[model samples]
Target: MDTLLSAPILFFMLGSIIALAGARIPFPEGFDKALAAYLLVAIGLKGGVALTTADTATVLPLLLTAGLISLLMPLLGFALLRSAVGLDRVNAAAVAAHYGSVSLVTFVTATKVLESSGVPFGGHMVAALAIMEGPAIITGLLLAGATGVTAVAAGAGGGTMSMPIDDGRDEGRDEERGGSLREAVREAAFNGSVLLLAGSLLVGLVIGKPGLEKLSGLFVAPWDGALSLFLLGMGYLATSRLREAASLSARLIAFGLVMPLLGAVIGLAAASALGLGLGDAVLMVTLCASASYIAVPAALRHALPTADPGLSLPLCLGISFPFNILVGIPLYVAMSRALLG
Candidate 1:
């Protein structure tokens, strides 16, 4: 309970409350975008710097594990969502990819808490971020394609599924009628958030630590301040949007809350098998446990356009992300120690 009421969650709550009260506090949308960009750059640069400090030998095995987690966890998430919820394959797969992927902010917050607590973890986990981000995204596209087929099969006779009519159609008409699912898949993959994050990471890595050191003040110094302001705006936005969500679907909420715990267990067990130390184990578990808001939501907008954002966003950012950061991290830490000891 003490963990639940910790400073981080309290700060988040304060943001939520002020937003719910309908205070017309002006936060420029451009400022939010700038803040997001700064955060991605700062975190990516920090990750790259930390990677530069890691031993290549140790980094390789951990990198392999991170890559494996990125590849496999999405399938696990997809199965769970398919069995637990009635979500169609595309939406389930999209949401599954998200659950398996890491949330950069949540990971950053966990790192801050661990540092404050004087817990030790490897710098190599930063590389894990780079490893995991792309695979889940690619998997999500495949899942969407699979779901589109399922949709077509299910709606075959419902009048929604259209067949290419063959009333002596011309070659141009035939070509026009035969649209492929690859196009939808491509659209989802090349989204704004994925491109921004991938681009920022590349820039941060190519620029390296020296380039980042020159601008640490704006990116590093005021990071917490920017986060606070961003959260404040987000809290207001969530509250305003979620007023109608009190009666929202409970099944989805439960899924959002529980999946992180499951993911943490899988990640922690993998860490133990690989002989990861306490700090790395905690972070690995945290990464598995965390879900993406920025990347997945954007992908889902393109992929699962019919999926309820009001239901999805608040469940992810408002409920699950905060729950994991505030309470789940400390709990996972304690549990990892007990189990792995």
Candidate 2:
């Protein structure tokens, strides 16, 4: 509890408050987008620097685990939503993929907290993070494909089959292709987050620690300051979106909050089985526990247009996101230490 109320969390809360209150401040919305780009770059670069700290042997196993989690968890999440929630196939799968995937902001904050508390994490966790984003996006599309196939089978000679994705600000667009699994794979692999993360990873690998250390004085030096400013913008964005829409259902809220815990526990077990240290375990749990608000939502909007974004995004960014960043992280760290140590 004392750990949860530490300075970093308080800084985050302060940023959230500023974001919610900054509506009248005369900055252009485009400025916020630029801030987001900076945040992403900073995060990617930092993750790269961290990766440079890893030995070769530790890197492979953690990277492999990250990839497997990215592949497996989304499929499991989709199955659970379909069987239990009765969401249509595409919607269930899309939401499942988002929940299964990673959140960059959450990952950044977790790393900071771990470092501040003097917990040593593996550098390859960033590799794990970079690897984690694409799989869930692929799985969501696969789930959508199954839905499309089922619809085709059931409605032959009857009606058109449409699978819609919903995001709160606007209606989603379809992937603009049909009847080719290869195209789906291409779309998933080439998504924006994958491009950025992969680019950053390659840059980091090429630059190595010496190069990163030179740039770190600028990019890494005021990271907390940058994150606070960025998260404040996020808070404003979140609150404005919330004000524009109605509140979410209790079930959806529960789903958002609880599902991450399940993912974290699963990740803890996986890390322990793989014999990861405290830092790696915490990062693994954090990645599993964090839900994607950016990449998955964008993919879902294109691939599943009819689904409700109101249900998905709010539950994810609004409810679960805040809970995980503020509360779930500290709890997960403590739990990982207790179990893995």
Candidate 3:
């Protein structure tokens, strides 16, 4: 409970409350993007510095395990959505992609919790994070294709299939050309967020501790404050989109709450099987449990155009994101301690 009441969380709640009450908070333009970039760069640098001392043998296996988890999570999520929640193919695949990916903000928050608790984790977890980002996107795309939901329109009509005609002759020409998939894959792999994180990680690895020490004043000192502000923005975004969430069915809402728990269970199993310690286990659980609000949304906008952003965004950003931060993080930590100890 004390952990839940921490400053970052409180700021997030305050922002949500203010937004829900229809109060206007004047945030400077591009401030949110700036905060995100700063946080990612800081985290990548810290991870790289930590990697300098990490054991390669352990890191390799953990990275592979995290990647495998990322690939499989969407498959599980898609199946559950289709069989249990009864979401259509496009919506199911789109939502599945989100669950399969990790939220950088949530991962950062978990790191802070671990740090405050005096828990030690590997720097290579960042590699795991980067690796986990793309596979689920691919998997979701494949699922959509297999179900013939690709090229659907991006509206609230729920997976109605339609293709735009260029001069009435290009109808089905775009589909035949297979251009959209290529674009989505490129976006998923080379998206600004992924590139910055991966590049920063590499830079950190090359520079090691000396580089980190030199840049610590900028990246390290102001991390928590930046995160609080970013999360405050997140709070406002989530509540503003809360109306969209009402369009989702009861079953889909239940899936939003349930998927994180399931992911955590899968994470615990993986961590235990790999003999991870307390902090790493918690972080692993967090990676598995946290759904992407940033990367996947952008990719899906291009990839699954017909997959309603209205549905997936609200479920992920508004519902799952908050649940994981407020309730899921502590729960995963407790589970990690009990198991890892």
Q: Best candidate per TM-score, number? A: 3
Query: Lowest summed-lDDT stretch of 10 residues in model 3?
Result: 156-165
**lDDT of candidate 2 at residue 280, scale 0 to 100:** 80
After superposing candidate 2, which stretches have Cα over 4 Å from the reference? 1-8, 18-28, 149-184, 240-246
How far out, in Å, is residue 221 in model 2? 0.9
Residue 151 displacement (Å), model 3: 0.9
Question: Candidate 2 lDDT, tens digit per residue, 1-341?
Answer: 65556555675566566656654445576876666666666667766777766677777877888888888888777777777667777668768888878888888778888888898876577778878876877777676765433222222223244534344422122223342334445655687766776777678777878888888877788777776666665655555555533475555566777789999988998889888989889989999998888877665554555455667777677777778877898889989989976
Give every collision pair in model 1.
none
Residue lDDT tens for model 3, 1-341: 87677778888898899898999668999988999999889999989888989998899999999988998899999999999999888779889999999999889889988877788998889889998998888888878766533375446343456433235645454573266567677888998999999889998999999989898889988888988898898888878777678888899999999999999999999999998888889999999999998788888776677787787889988789888888999999999988878
Error of 3 at 11 (Å): 1.0
TM-score per candidate, chains pooled: 0.79, 0.83, 0.92
Better of 2 and 3 by lDDT: 3
CA lDDT of every candidate: 0.68, 0.72, 0.86
